[model samples]
Target chain A: MERLAFELESAGPPAPRAPPVVVGVVASGNLEVLVEPGDLAGRCRVEVATSANGFAEIWDAVLRDFAARNAVAGLALSVNDAGATPAVVSLRLDQAVEEYLGQRP
Target chain B: MTPGNPGHLPARRSYREATARRRLAGILDPGSFTELLGPSERVTSPHLAGLGLAVAFDDGVVVGRGLLGGRVVLAASQEGGFMGGAVGEVHGAKLVGLLRRAERERPAGVLLLLDSGGVRLQEANAGLVAVSEIMRALLGARAAGVPVVGLIGGGWGCFGGMGIVARCCDALAMSEEGRLGISGPDVIEATKGVEELDAADRALVWRTYGGKHRYLLGEADLLVEDDLAAFRDAAAALLASPRSLDEGALAREHERLARRLADFGGCTDAADVWRAAAVPDPDRLPLLDADAFRRAVAAARGEEP
Candidate 1:
């Protein structure tokens, strides 16, 4: 999970407009996330700070998978967690991105 | 047959079962409770179990509608046995929804049997948002002439944002075994040293944070025994009573809370407050039970208990 203070980066076309950057609590034993459009167009860099450490590799792997599957670029993803596992985190992150993109005009 | 006794102890189970049992037996009549998203409905929190936490079908709070003294009532009760009666997303959602239903019905009133530590730290954001929604719903019900009676008699009592939520209610009732405070002894102990709050000092802590103390300080409207029947009766009576708060009364209540913070400025012990409130022999508080505590305090003030 990510802390209140988190940042991310991406490469390619800058977001044409400011995308919805939603951040907040997920649930107990759950995770909260923030996904916003960024300046990069082709690359996505994810940052995670979690209460449960020693799981950073899993977090990176989840992000890698999410990036590989989605055309989501120039976007930032951040998470805050109490004890949310990597898979659940990935799912929520994807959901947030999906929800935000759906809201795009 | 003895009065105030259900004559048989209710069946026991996990937090979910206890919640169902309590909700079923709490209202004015048997067979009156209609659960919103009960166990058979399977509205458990996907957010909790996804993270490997034991998730109950009801999440943590039981929400439903029933009859109380011939008037319709919607109520919510927390399950302290589960996750410290913590508030998760669905738990908070169910609560907000129940309050919404109460406002919609606007029949008798809404009752909340709260025993939560507030904002499930796991689902922090969702829980926080849900609490605000519940508060808004409560305010709506109040505007519609529905009184919101909060019962703070669970083992966990209330804390954090939930504590604030309970305070926002029109009135509150409690029992000796229950507590009502913003933070737990451990949290205080962690923030301050043991010397500051002394989590181990049960007597001091109880007098300072217990239901009896809050009742004396006027935080709780009713103080009764811990038996479930007592609570049920109190809820019935409160639901029928004229709602004492409206838009203006509520706005002024906030002022009273702020005054509490100011008047209680930097006090180290409850004994100080006892002396400040001018109770006789504030030092003699630890020896009193519920009845004795009430009697001693009242007598100290030259009044009948």
Candidate 2:
């Protein structure tokens, strides 16, 4: 098992009041994302726990891209990955954010 | 689309291969099922992430309400593809909540599409406690006169605590491929040695705890085909004639279970039990068709065949 954490500052303002959201299942080739309100000062904190090790750079790249594209400030995002590809990881992150904002994706 | 409405129906698929959501859709009336804690709710487990295991939004169990043959019913289906459909804290709690809801709402019946390998090994203690809670909830639902029907035909058959849970239901529906046992063959072989129970002998394992054997032993109420339609029809029939959970039925069940335990307490081989039940040529029983096996068991029991 591998545990990784990351923090990134977003250019946009903090997200509005929103409830926490979870998306996806933790099965082979799949992952689940949990997004909740955080006390970060215009920055998003991300933590990932994965069964497959040696994927720190991949996770960092994915989270960095996600933070740049989404206004995730003041939000905490966690992921439970089970050897999922980068594409699936990105999709679930977007889904978690969309669900947290109470919007259909 | 709601569960029961007929606007859209999924392509015909085998129940054994269908996902948990697909199974629920097939059982309920089209457009009638309204999930209580849907995936959108995102009520995931708080424990698995720490262990570095994957977590699911719905905790691997899908619980909701739907109309089965025009009667309101509470339904739950386990996702066999997720961690072998094992019951964890959140998954078990969902089931407990559904059963408790049945007690209060008093739906036509409670339908459980069980595909669990029992408690989750990762969260062993929590899973065991949750199963116990589910048992208590089942008893409560029974006391409230709510029928609980379990269907076991998914990739993983009911085992561990769930095997007993299925037996506690008012009725159980099973496919020929389904198995109902407390301990799996692997566990038994590991603990008692391969000589005691060969784990690799699939035929022997099936003969011991498979649907046909359980049906013959009067454990499973209905034995149908592997198709979803067969299961739906059986469920409809069961819900139509809800069994009363009165003292008489309780006493009968108690006596039946006690007699069963006492009758086969010392028997190691399934064939011996069959022979004691007066099943002629007990060795050939496993090869019989479902209908034929039912008739044979009834004839052996001196019931109308």
Candidate 3:
């Protein structure tokens, strides 16, 4: 298993206050993302645990891009990956954020 | 697929490949499934993340209320793709909660889309306790005159604690591909020598625990094709004329189970069990289709079924 954690600075203010949210399932070629409120000030913290090893740089780039695009400050984003591609990881992150912000009914 | 749109339709799909959400949608009246503790709730398994394992948002089980054939029902479907649909603490709790709701609300029936490999070994003790709680909840629902039906056609055959739980339900609807067994063939072969039970003998495995065998033995209440619509229709019919869990019915079930135990206590061969059941040409039953097999079993029992 591979374990990695990082914190990224967001461009805008923290996201709207809402309850924690989780999205997706962690199966082969799939992943689940968990987003919870945190005392991160204006940053988003991410921790990833994956069954496949040696993709730290790839995960870092994907999470970095996501944090920069979304106003995800003051939140902790955790991912349980099971060999999911970069596209699926990004999709789940977007879904989790949308659910947290109540963008979905 | 949209809420409150009776005309909305989902493309016909095989139940075997459908996801948990899709199964619920296919089984319930279109737009009638109101999920509780949905993925948006973030109610994941705390133990899995702590142990460096993957954690699902709904903890691998989806529980909620839905309308089936214009009747209110509580339903649950296990995500077999997630952790082999193992019953962890939260997963089992969801099922228990649904059954408890059924007991309280007294819905027309409770439908369980079971595709689990039983308790999650990662949280062994908690999973076991949760399964026991679910069993109690199921009995409570039955006592309340709410029929509990189990549908087994997921990727993972029902096994372990869940297998026994399925048997305890008022009725079980199974497909040919589905299996119902206390222990998996591999587990038995590994624990006991190959001479005791060969894991590689696929034919033997199916003949022993497959839907056809169980249906013939009266373990499974209904054997149907592996189509979501077929299962939904069967469930609707069952709820339309629900089974009673009255004193007399319970006594009869008790006698049937006891007789099963007494008849097959020391039996290992599948043929022996069939012969003991007085099924003529027992070797041909397993080769027949589900409908034909059901007819043969009914005929053997001298029933009008």
Candidate 4:
């Protein structure tokens, strides 16, 4: 297995603009995402670097869907993936938001 | 092999013979393990290759999905014979990734068979950060109601950041052959003088750093024989137990460690704490098999060792 890595950082405020928090961790076959508003810019930016070479397209789809859906501004999302299934990757991404930015469990 | 028999890990051999692929076979379940980044991955350290040292595939850590008692558990074990089981950036990432999977699947448990000297000095900065990240993931798993168990079975033991990681686990199972501490004996000896820990004095090293001492002090929860079968059983029993630790238990763990530091006060003689804990014959205690020792000591204290 290749060490497929993908990372994304965005500037500006969420669609509604809110507080900032940092979340995420990188491990084999999984990822921990941290999403919190910061002083980047008005537009959201995402970056992804992975050890897995051929999965970039899959990551693009997932992150694109997330950005389009959330549209939260000024927030940064950093991902360190170790070959996670697309579903698991997205779950952690969504959970990272819930943990650091979203409602309390 | 079982209690009556044994295996010589870190046995004198070539890298292929001393590899974790062979070691983990006996550690985890039979025919249930699927390597995540097996030898074929070739995930060697780009940084280490620059330093001209040999780098193994899987970044020196063997990670996979396996079962203990058929309870589908995520597993990662260090290769002690390889570069003292140090954690590099990719090595650390692999671990956090598995922890993420554990959080997602709520695997019956996650077992990290720790065997490291600490962060790799060659890639020191990233390695240090990675250890901290792994710690956060460990905490997250606990919060998510999944058990994170650290098993110290390697001959090299664990130290530095890895030592802290081992302590943060919900439970730790250790063999007497393993040692856990922030700094290793050689480092301490180099600075504090061999008179302190005496890196060459095998007895003193074991007494100061061995798993038996950790067990008696409650630093290690379950003490098992120095064989794969014993270690495997402890993992299975924990899976069968109620998943997460109750608050009361965590509280007691804190109290025990604090009391130990307060009372022991940086003493070099570990037997002091053992005797104070009412362990009979602290000197001979290290030689006893894990089960016999537990029956003798933990039974008297009415606490899990």
Q: Which of 2 and 4 is ahead in TM-score? A: 2
DockQ of 4: 0.02
**Superposed Cα deviation of residue B3, candidate 3 (Å):** 41
lDDT of each prediction vs. the true structure?
0.70, 0.86, 0.86, 0.72
- Per-residue lDDT tens digits for candidate 4, residues B108-200, read 888888889999999999999999999999888878888888888677789999999998788888878888999999999999986667799
Which 10-residue window in model 1 chain A sums to the lowest lDDT? A1-10
Q: Write the per-residue lDDT of candidate 3 for residues A15-105, one digit (tens) a residue.
A: 7766566567788999878788877798888988788889999998998899888998889887878899999988889888987888433
For model 2, how does the per-residue alpha-carbon lDDT over B109-188 read when each residue is reduced to its tens digit? 99999998999999899999999999999989988988889999887889999988998888898887889999999999
Which clashing pairs does model 3 show? none
Tell how far residue B18 is off in model 1, in angstroms. Answer: 6.3
Candidate 4 — what's its lDDT? 0.72
Model 4: chain B TM-score vs. truth? 0.88
Cα lDDT tens digits, model 1, B84-121, are 77888899888888877777778688888888887888
Higher-lDDT candidate among 2 and 4? 2
RMSD in Å for all candidates? 13.8, 6.9, 6.3, 15.5
Chain A of candidate 1 compared with the true chain A, TM-score: 0.74
Instruction: Tell me how candidate 1 scores on lDDT.
Output: 0.70
Judged by TM-score, which candidate is best?
3
Tell me the tens digit of each residue's lDDT in model 2 across A1-105: 888999987888898756566566677998878787887889999988788899899889988998999999999887777899999998889888887887433
lDDT of 4 by residue, A1-105 (tens): 333333444333454444433233234555444454544565555544454668878887887666655544565654445456888877776775665555332
